[model samples]
Target: MPEREPLAPAVAATRLAVRRALAPYAGGAVVAGVSGGADSLALAAALAFEAPALGIAAVSVTVDHGLQAGSDAAARDAAEACRAMGLEARIARVEVAGPGGPEAAARRARLDALRAAAAQVGARAVLLAHTLDDQAETVLLGLARGSGATSLAGMSPARRDPDGLTWLRPLLGLRRGDTVAACAAQHLAPWQDPHNADEAFARVRVRRSVLPLLEAELGPGVAEALARTADQLREDDEAFRDMIDETIEDIVEHAEAGIAVSVAALAANPAALRHRVIRHVVASEFGVSLTRTQTLEVGRLVTDWAGQGPIDLPGCRATRSGGMVVFAARA
Candidate 1:
């Protein structure tokens, strides 16, 4: 085999990241998501070079939301770019509509399409090109909304879905500038998405204005610090989940209508664990996340039960009965 030429530093960095991420899936097929942006283009290029050498079949899946003029053309161009790098490419055009506004809806639609596209090629893993900058923005958004630990944890580098598909973000440690430099080194022309510049979107505002301003005031490294905080919080979240699982196993019971938790166990726990237990029970049994206030109300049933009536939750009703905090399905 002919020896490949030396790669530029930025290109080498991205390829190295992708190579490491692909280590566990050497013999498996993967779907590389491309949006024609610098980040994804660099990712696709890296995958093209790395996957084949590791005996992995990598295909590029470009999802077109068709929300803007010439979106189809853009998708085609992205696919062609992947093909140029010797990767099999496919375009999945999806209609984006649902709750949580356009951005969230579009993301949901895109992931669904990507999963379907992966199924077509028998791939079990999807690669996303989210960078460290993206992670910082997510943390900032979580802080703004006063969200819990889960939201502040940001995106995981790798996660598996219950349906069997795995999501991998190989470039999570790299900055966005690294991707642009990588594309330049690889001689790839990425489509510049206009929405990225429009401050109308919250993420764009965070990227363009909020982060930069924070960096200036904080004397740099603000984004990196936020990303580090997310990493630590993710570790903490994993540990907390383990503790919750063990505690729930001991305190939970099957009820006539739903599940029940022992009031004795709830009272024995510290306040933090007590609140978390209340929230977890509702989320797991009823498939609804309670707000902080709702969780506290549920806890109060154990800590300060004054013969109050059943507390209505989103999908269930919590009642104190027979020394048990019972969560029954709402009729």
Candidate 2:
């Protein structure tokens, strides 16, 4: 008999990434969120190959946002492909609604459905197919928004959601082209989303125009550089979070209406940590994010105090009360 060809480099690389990602979840059930696109299809294929070896019972979930024509059929097709690879599959049909435009609404709905599916299937983790290219695009979008380090930090490889389901992205170190090549090597045909080519979306524009322009002008490796920046920022953000946790415990006190932080402590800390502490306090207390202007305005209550009256915030008010900066719910 002829010797079987070795696994293609791209296919081997993708499977290796998935294997490492699922190592910690050995013997646990995992759901791969497959969109039928090349990236997700490659992920599903890799999970199917590696799950059994790692004692993981894998399931592929195809979330149908029903945004486009034939979306349901496409979702079914994705599930069928997963089953063909010897993995259990599910199709989650979800209605895309709420604020934040169509793309955001669809994404939110899809994620909710994925989490629900994971719970139904008793899976502890839902693996996503976001690659290095996606991470770079996320960083660029964050930069465009003029966001802080936390926002620029981009997506983590693994994160546990509020519902206690872990989300994993194993391919963040691989390029999108690698996934495409892997699909081809495996003889898997991927469904192409037309929206990916539509320039109406900001992400599409970044992927199609902005990234190419950067690569052209800068020679190459722009995406890798952006992904590296995200990794570095994430490390810094983690350290800062640790510092904030320790400082908050000592400097924060429960107030009658809300929470209060020691004004002297906040003023003494460096501006970076102080601002984050203020933002964290407001967000944790009132569940509302403060704009930069709002944050700085509140900061002035400590750094540039001039007996300013109570400042009205979205869900609360910030006022100076002797030694503490009190954040009280708006009456």
Candidate 3:
């Protein structure tokens, strides 16, 4: 008997990733955020293939940012591709106007549109096509900015938003090349966004030039190394978050103006956790982020406590009162 034809590696990899991701949400629906790009089209194809046998329902939602001419047609083509794959598809038109630049603003608008599409289909989760290359680029940017572990941690594979919607990125471990190869293997035509090639965006520069230079200078696996760093940091960050949540329940208390934590308890913990606690407290109570400087100053109120007056924060003030480090609203 003749040997059976082996499945293409790219097709096999994409299918495996989608199968693993759809397991948890079995018998439920999910929305795939497709951009008609190689990554997203590959994701939609994988979802189309894997979701059916698992009793999972999937929909493709393409957001038209209207940033360029013919964007609506692009959205329609994406949806038609999904339809050809035997999945329901939708197009959401959004105006990308916000504080951030075009890239950031488009992302914000796209996410909002995706969420609404998920809501329409009663999907509890939205699947994105962020690949390992994206994660590596994010880590590079984080490193360049000297950001905290939260930034270094890069994007999580899965995250639950406050509104009960979950975001899942199954391709975080797959390379951008894998997606491109998968699309080619399946004979799918992916739309190339002009913005991706435009060097005006910092991310485009990283993708087009910086990453290639790093790979040439260092080695072939530099991108993989950066992504691995992100994975390790994310694990550490998760553990610290669990610890902080438990500690917060024990030491935090309601106050007249805001919130407080036991000074002795704060001082007893290691500096790493102590700083996170202060930042968490201010963020939860005042809805403002504490800089590294601000976090250290609030931490000093616990360790030093030299009768310094309240140090004003963005939306609150920190002071040591009695046996508690109090964070109160700004007067």
Candidate 4:
């Protein structure tokens, strides 16, 4: 066991967050995403310090996006810092293929590296240091996309990856300043990634431009307000999702590319519940989620349609093909 040092407020908060996120999957190793920045480095330190008591170990992983000139050196510095903190650290360099565009390619590459590192260590989960500010940004971005509750609900603290590994964000409730403060309190110099300030990214635009404007105009607590809205929406969305799951157990049937909903069963439900059911079916089966306008279209399909007709959607199409409504991708 490592000697206990007095943890700073930021470090203590980080520790609590990490512990809460991993409580369900006790005693398993956690792969910490270390980007050489203050946020991730502080998270790495907290996890390393708390690991012994929790019966879990922490491994640091630095994904070199290979986009910047000194990215490799930055990754090496990150690994060295992790090693100094008594964590086993490794660097994964990834090539960013641009067919999907640079940002998309880099994101896929980064997650791929993180997943690969977790697999190598036999870790069941990965910890990401996304803060409260990030969550607000996500919510605002989702709003700008005109997407509904699920998109506005933003990221989950713990989500199962498609491959069954878990990805957790322990620092989601804390601010970026807190992470920087933690590094300063520990006498650690954390790197500032230049990309964070670049206006090329929408997130950067929101963080640097929109948030500041909102704070100035709305009086300082706008981020908290937005985050609160996201939290409430998340709760509502989860309940609705659960209802849909249970409803599907009774009302859904296998179809060609998607599922078919029994019109009689669906029509019996209240308007709000029926809307959620339709949204869930579109999102789950055909990977199509209705926007505000699309939701109205779906409502018409249920209530106003006197006869069978088609409703066009992104990635798929919906229609009253028979007595029951069917949603499937167009052949």
Candidate 5:
């Protein structure tokens, strides 16, 4: 009998990555979010291959945003591909309607659909196919927005959202070309979304123009560098969050209308930690994200307090009273 060839390198690499990502969720059901794109198709294929060995029942979910023509058919085809891999599959048709633009609205709707699908299937985690290139683009977007460390940290490998659904991005360390090669090796024809090549979208422009420009201008490894920067920033942000949580427990008090933090404590900490604590408190209490200017203005009530009356903030107001900086609900 003729000997069977070993699995292709790209396929082996993808399966190894998926296996490592699913290790923690052993024996639990997992859902792969497939968009019929090369990245997601590779992810779905790898999950289908690795889940059985990990004792996980894998399911593929395709979300149809209905933005473009034939979207539903594309979603159905993705589901069919998953089924062909011997995994359960589902299609989630979501209505993309919200305040944000089409891209943002579509993303929000797709996430909601994925979470709902995961819950329905009793899956403990949903695997997403956001590759290293995606992370680099995210960092670039954050830089363009002049965001802080948390925003520049990009996406985490695994995160449990407020709704308690665990989201996993197993391909964050893999390159986009790796996924494309994996799909080719598996003989899986991926659907190319028109939006991906549309220059009107900021992400598409970044993917098509800016990234290539950077790679050309500065040689290579720009994406890897950006991804590394995100990884490092994420580690720092996690540590800072831990410190903030501990400090808040000791120094924060429940106010009549909102929350109060000790002015002395705020002033004593380093500037970075102090600012983060202030922002975290406001976000956690009032569900408002303070801009850098707003956060600094509030920080002034602690470090640079004089006889200032009250600083109006989004959804709340900050006032310096005695030894505490009180954030109260705006009347």
Candidate 6:
């Protein structure tokens, strides 16, 4: 790929990833999540130095997960790095909790902090430093779980944040080593989080255990190939979602508590789109999401359970009433 001006290849690649992810906000300011790691620091430095003329303003945000003893100091260090780059920076601390487990809890808190910071700066987009390796790990983990496309596809480059702001990944296509090289070139100090090397985490196990094995057995480009696969799946999923949106627009019936779908209209769609459309309806109407098993059960209902009673979902039920499939919560 061609280099973005005034930045080295690694930095240029980082910027390209972020810019492409945030293409919807072509001329807007961006809030970057800088975790003081090589990847994030390089991204912060590159965006600060390379994006002004491109009509992109940058803000650096450091989230202190508060998991380790010195996480606060690390956040401060990240903030200092941003200041050194001549960009405004903020240090946000989040107290990660349970019920979702530690990993997911930490992620939720970190995103919450980033979103808050983005809002404070009036930024409409938040940029993250997830690399190609992270994408591969995600895909592998998803594959291990045996879920369908949504899981296997891994993360999207850009998506809606919790606060409804756009979240962009500008380093998803670059390797971790490239970010390290960029840090070296820029003389920036990057923090090495010990949790990354800790084998206790599932992601670490995937990164340290699964990925290396795949590289040795399959090929050197295994990680890249996995990430590429995710990108392809993401594209396919998006197109499928667009088709679902169109179908919903044409055949939806909004009720007091939830929505109903015309059984005939749903049956007309292909099985793939049919399943997706049913899941969308369940999610939109009752704020309930279907699991893989639950989704298949719902799919079976389309043919076998034509005139049956209500089927249970996460937060609601799907019932065949008259000529439509109604999704509703029990009153």
| Worst window of 10 by summed lDDT in candidate 3 | 98-107
Total residue pair clashes for candidate 4: 0
Report lDDT (CA) for all predictions.
0.93, 0.94, 0.92, 0.86, 0.93, 0.83
lDDT of 1 by residue, 77-178 (tens): 999999999999999999999988999999999999889888988888999999999999999999998888889999999999998899999999999999
In terms of lDDT, which candidate is strongest? 2
lDDT of 3 by residue, 239-266 (tens): 9999998889899999989998999898
Q: On residues 41-156, what C-alpha lDDT tens digit does candidate 4 reach at each position?
A: 98888887777777887899999988888999999999999999999999998989965688889989999999998998889999998988999999999999887788899888
Model 2 misplaced stretches (Cα beyond 4 Å): 162-164
Which scores better on lDDT, 1 or 6? 1
Candidate 6 local lDDT, 1-331, one digit each (tens): 9875575777667666655665666577789999999989988877776667567777898988889999999999999989889788888888899666999998989888988887877889888888899999999988988877988889887788455798877788789999998898788989999998999989999988999998999889999999999989999998998888666888878865788888788778788888888888887766666877887777766666746678888888778777778777767
Clashing pairs in 2: none
Error of 3 at 59 (Å): 0.5
TM-score of 3: 0.93
What pairs collide in candidate 5?
Answer: none
Residue pairs with clashing backbones, model 6: 17-170, 18-170
Candidate 1 residue 164 C-alpha distance from true site, Å: 3.1
Answer with 3 or 4, whichever has the higher lDDT: 3
- Write down the worst ten-residue block by lDDT for model 5: 160-169
Off by over 4 Å in 1: 1-6
Cα RMSDs of all predictions? 2.1, 1.2, 2.1, 3.1, 1.3, 3.8
Candidate 6: deviation at residue 130, Å?
Answer: 0.8
Q: Say which prediction, candidate 2 or candidate 4, comes out ahead on lDDT.
A: 2
Which regions of candidate 4 are displaced past 4 Å? 1-7, 22-26, 97-101, 161-164, 256-258
Give the least accurate 10-residue stretch of model 2, judged by summed lDDT: 158-167
**What local lDDT does model 5 show for residue 185?**
94
